[model samples]
Every structure is written in C-alpha cells, then in structure tokens.
Target: MSNILRIATFNVHKGLSTFNARFSLHDQRELLRKLHADIVFLQEVQDEHAKHSKRFSPFPLNGQLEFLADAVWPNYSYGKNSVYPAGHHGNAVLSKFPIINTENRDISAHSVEQRGMLHCEISIPGWDQTLHCICVHLGLFARWRTKQLQEVKRFIEDHVPADSPLIIAGDFNDWSLNAGRSFAESLHLREVFEHSHGKPAQSFPSWLPILRLDRIYTRGFSIRHVEVHTGPTWLKVSDHAVLTATLAHQTA
Candidate 1:
C-alpha cells in the first residue's frame, strides 16, 4: 500500500501570468500537473467568463479548476466565493484518492472581498482512517480575517474528527495579520513550510516575493520533508510560490 502522500498549496492568481500579459489555463494546468501532488489545494480558481480572459488572452474551454486539474487529477471540488462582472472565482481541491465527502463553506466577512474554504474527505489506500483536506482563502482586512478565522476554527471543530489525519492549506493573506496563528494554535496545527524552510516564503511578486501569504499545515501527519518549489518553472507559474510536503502518518 503506497500511503506515501504528497500535498501542495498554491494561489494560482486566477491562472493569469503574474499580472503579466500571458493568460493561458493550459500553462497553469501543465505547471500543476508536473508537481503531481497527491492532494492539491488551490486559491483563485476562475469558473467562467471568457470575455474577461480573452481581453488578456484566449484560455482553454474548461473552467480554471477543471483546466488546472486537467485529466491528470481524477477527483476535484470548487468552492466559489468572489463574483464579478468578469466571472466568479474561488478555491479548489484536487486529489488522487477516492473522495467520500465534500463541502464548501463561505467565510466572507465583508463586502469588499469574498473568500471561502473547500473541505474534502478522501479515503487513502493504506490508512485505516480517511484523510481530511481543506482549501482556504482569507480576506485582505486583518479584523475581518480574524472573524473568518474564528468561523474556520468552528467549522473544523464541528466537521472534522480530532483523531483523524488532517491537512489545512492555502492563502491566508497574512501580510500583517495573526489570524493564521489565532486559529492554528487552538487546533494545534503545525505549518509545513515554516517548520522546514522558515517564516519568509518569498511568494508575492513571484520574482521578488514580498509577502508570506501561502502555507501548508497538518496535525495528524508527521512531516518527513517540505519545500518551497522555487525552481525555474515555479518562478514563472504563479505569483505565490507553491509549498509541498511529504507526510508520514503518525502511527499510533
């Protein structure tokens, strides 16, 4: 039984070219497929509106989530939060295992920005218990994010099993916010990137990286390895750097 699972979290910037002119969903799909993460959590997944994307460039026919997942990833789910004249966008999850249950929670705290979380329960091959995967996207304001984080905590407490293997990852927009710590501490979640690489995860401008906004966290899994995925292909993929981790389940 190949229980060796790898998970990754990335904010795809809506499959755009890091504020550049390039707008090809296929490129984003290729980038993510190359990673081959067992469970992939993504923020800024565009669902529709070719008119807006066409202005930038012609993208693929499938929605951003489907496009990114492509045929490589067998299972996926989308949690829509933000809506605009251009279209609606949100978070998404892609997994290789059989997904047993799924839900999308709206945690938007203000009208200015929309955010959401996607929860998916997957059945792993070797594990006696199922895997819980969460995809999160927080707001811009600190106060609003705090409230959202509280809701997120409650959601976890109500839905997820405390004794099961858990993974929560995505964009926190923690430019100067403590929401990550506020909710994470209460649940005893340890960040993968920060634990392995450090606090600063150069992920903003893609090229320069000014903010530590993205993260991968887990409690029931023992992290054996972690990386920031900052190679040549990564530098051109998305504004936020993708964080990946290989977890060895804590055998009781």
Candidate 2:
C-alpha cells in the first residue's frame, strides 16, 4: 500500500483580514477545514490576545491553534514567538496523526522580531519511523531571514535522524527567492512548487499575489501535486495564499 499525504502551509495573519479590517478567525477556521490537509503548518497564529478577545465578537476563548484545530486535527503543537502586553502569537502544526514529541526553538535575530521554529515528531499509523515536521515563520529583513535559515538547518542536523521523512513549511518571507537554493544545497530538500512548476508559487498579498513568500519543502517523498489557494474568499481570510502539496512516501 502506498502512503500519500496531503499537507498545507499558511500564514493566517493572526486571524485578521487585511489592514485589520475585520476579525476573520471564524472564516479562517472554515477555510482550513475545506483544505482537508493531513498536516497543516501555520504561522502568525495568535495563542492569546487580551484586547482582541474583548473586541472581536466570536474570538476564541482558548486560542487560535485550538480553535483552528478543533475536532478536525486532533493533534497540535504551538511555538510562541512574539509576546507583548496585548498577548502572544507564533507558529503551529496541526496533524491527523499522533504527535509524540514537540519542541520550540527561538531563532530571533533581534529583539524586535521574535521568531521561532516549531518541531514535531508525528507517529503515522503503520509507519515504522516517525515523521519530522517543522513549522517556521522567518523575519522580515533579508539578513535576519538568512541567519534564521542557518539556525533551522543546524536544528535539523542536530536533532532529526538522517534517514527520517522530514518536512519544513511556513512563511519564509523570502522575496529574493534565495532560500530554495540554500535548502536544496544544504539539506537536499525540494520545494514542492519549485519542483513541479520550476519556481516557487507567488503567495503574498493574497488578493493579487505577486511575491513568493510562503513555501513547503520536503525530503523522502515524491511530489505528486501542488497548489496555491488564492481567491476572493481566501483573500478575506489572510494576506498570504495557502500552499498545499500531495506527496507519496518513498519507502526504503
């Protein structure tokens, strides 16, 4: 039997519409369910927001991660990256499989931009080895992103087993498009859209996407299909388009 997995990466903009025009967490949760992803990598998810809780009518009392993962994805992990008086926000991974282990690493290049990588080891049914998943949100500046990428590489090299099935996905903020080359050369990971379309999918400014800021990179899988979800409905959900990929596990 072949094991095919469908995964998605999205930057949810802290569950708010563009320009903070409105609170869209409810709509975002519905959209996530529609994706039907087996694993989801999310960035800019609000773990808590004291002010928003009072302002937004249907704000989740628990947190964005729990609200989004409600019932659909039974297993989830979050990495709190940025914290302020208002509350905290970060990256998260939601999976259908059992998540056995989770770790959050701070890779902030400066005090202003608090960034992190959320790593999870998931146990897929009938699989002999655990799958490694990393959810990341890089810094805005190119220099900071470069440093963060190195940190991610080091983290993987030190922790993940050499032969494990691995996936790293989220908002890279890499407008210059150099991160793909770095990942390919350093980690032998292939960006799904780049492998299929010869370039990364343009996923920024969801209304009319023209910049490749989001990505899904993987190892030990054969890319079957990849898509960028962008339309009027999606635009109302977030500023970045959702990137989804289908892969067939390559058995040893």
Candidate 3:
C-alpha cells in the first residue's frame, strides 16, 4: 500500500487553444502522461464540438476531457461551467484511486465571468481515509474574485468534511498575492506550494511567466515536495505551467 500521494494541477488553456496553430489537443495527452500524477486537476477543459475541434486538429473528434483522460487518467469527472457558441469549457479531476463522491460547484458570483470549482472525494489505498480535492478557477477581477473566494469558503464548509484531508488547487488568477493567503487562512488551509517553497509559482503566460497565478494548495496535508514544471515541454503544452506535489497527512 502506497501512502504517498502525488497530485498535480494545471490550466490546460483549452488544450492549448492557439488560434494560429489550432492543432486541437495536441501534445496535451503526452504531456500529462509524463507528469504521472496519482491525481490531476485540470482547468479549461473542453467537452466536444466539431466546430471548435476543426478550429483547433490534433484532437478533433473526441471530447477534450475524455480524450485526455482516456490517454492519461482513465477514471475522471468533469464539471462544465461556461457554455458559449465556441463550446463548453470547465474544470475536471482525474484520479487513479476510487472516487467516492464528486460535485461541480458554480463559484461565479459575477454574471459577467464564468468560473467553477470541481470537488471530488477520493479514497486512496493506505491513507486510511478519503481526501477532498477541489479544482478551482477564479475570475479575472479582484473584487469579483474576492466574492467568489467567499463563496468557495461557504461551499467547502457546507460540503467537504472538516476532518478529511483537503486540497484546493488550480489557476487562482491572483497575481497580486495577498488575496490567496487571506482566503487560505480563513479556511484553515495551508497553501502547500508556498509553504514548501517561498511563494506561489509563476504559472500564467507560460511564455513569459510574469504573474504568479497558478497554485497547488493543501490544508490538512504536510508538504513534502513541491515542483513547478517549466522549460520547453511545458511551454508547448499550455499558457499556464503545471504545479506538482508530494504530500503526507499531518501526523498526530
């Protein structure tokens, strides 16, 4: 029985939706397989739409989430949020372990922006417990994001068990920094990336990495190892870099 839990979070930019290239899910499967995480939280995943598929090529005929999951994580769940003429896009959780419960919560307090948090309760072998994993993607504006964060807090309080190991991660879009820390403290959750390292990783704008937006956070887990996957392989995958971590439950 393996007690070590490997988790990773990434904003896949709708499978690298580059208007110019329009390759369509190109390299996403390959890239994710390389990460080899036990559980994965993905932001900006598309379901299916031939129009959009044609517009993007490497993966045109398959549901974006299914395609990626089939190749990488076989057992997974996706929560659709923003539905537009382009297609429906949202968050997804892929797990190698048994998923006992799952829900997709709408955290978009602002009607103007579409956002979501995909929560999944997974039963890992050897952990002797279930873990609450929430995959989040917040709004663009600070005010809207703040309200959304509060909503997220309420959601967690109402749904997730307090005693269960809690992991909330994804593209927070909080380049400013303070907001994330404030929210984490309020929820009694620890930001694993920041605790292990010095700060949240610079993940957005994968080309330049100006903003420290993407993060992997765990509230009840003791941080073991934290890694930000950068360099050439990541640059071709998405607009945001991936955050990976190895964690242990806080000991008594």
TM-score of structure candidate 1: 0.92
Worst 10 residues of 1 by lDDT: 229-238
Worst 10 residues of 3 by lDDT: 17-26
Among these predicted structures, which one has the highest TM-score?
2
The digit string of per-residue lDDT tens for model 3 on 29-98 reads 7777887898999998878655766655455575888788785566798998898876799999999888
Q: TM-score per candidate, in order?
A: 0.92, 0.98, 0.93
lDDT of 2 by residue, 1-252 (tens): 248999999999999987788898898889889999999999999989999999998888898899999999999999999999999999999999999999999999999899999999999987778899999999999899999999999999999998999999999989898865786679989999999999999998898899999988899999999999997666567898889999988888
Indicate which candidate wins on lDDT: 2
For model 2, what is the C-alpha lDDT against the true structure?
0.91
Error of 1 at 143 (Å): 0.7
Q: Give the lDDT ranking, best first.
A: 2, 3, 1
List clashing residue pairs in candidate 3.
22-56, 23-57, 23-58
Residue 216, model 2, lDDT: 89
Q: What is the C-alpha RMSD of each candidate to the true structure, in Å?
A: 1.9, 1.0, 1.9
- Candidate 1's C-alpha runs over 4 A off are 56-58, 198-200, 231-236
The candidate, 2 or 3, that scores higher on TM-score is 2
As a TM-score, model 3 comes out at 0.93
- What lDDT does each candidate get? 0.80, 0.91, 0.80
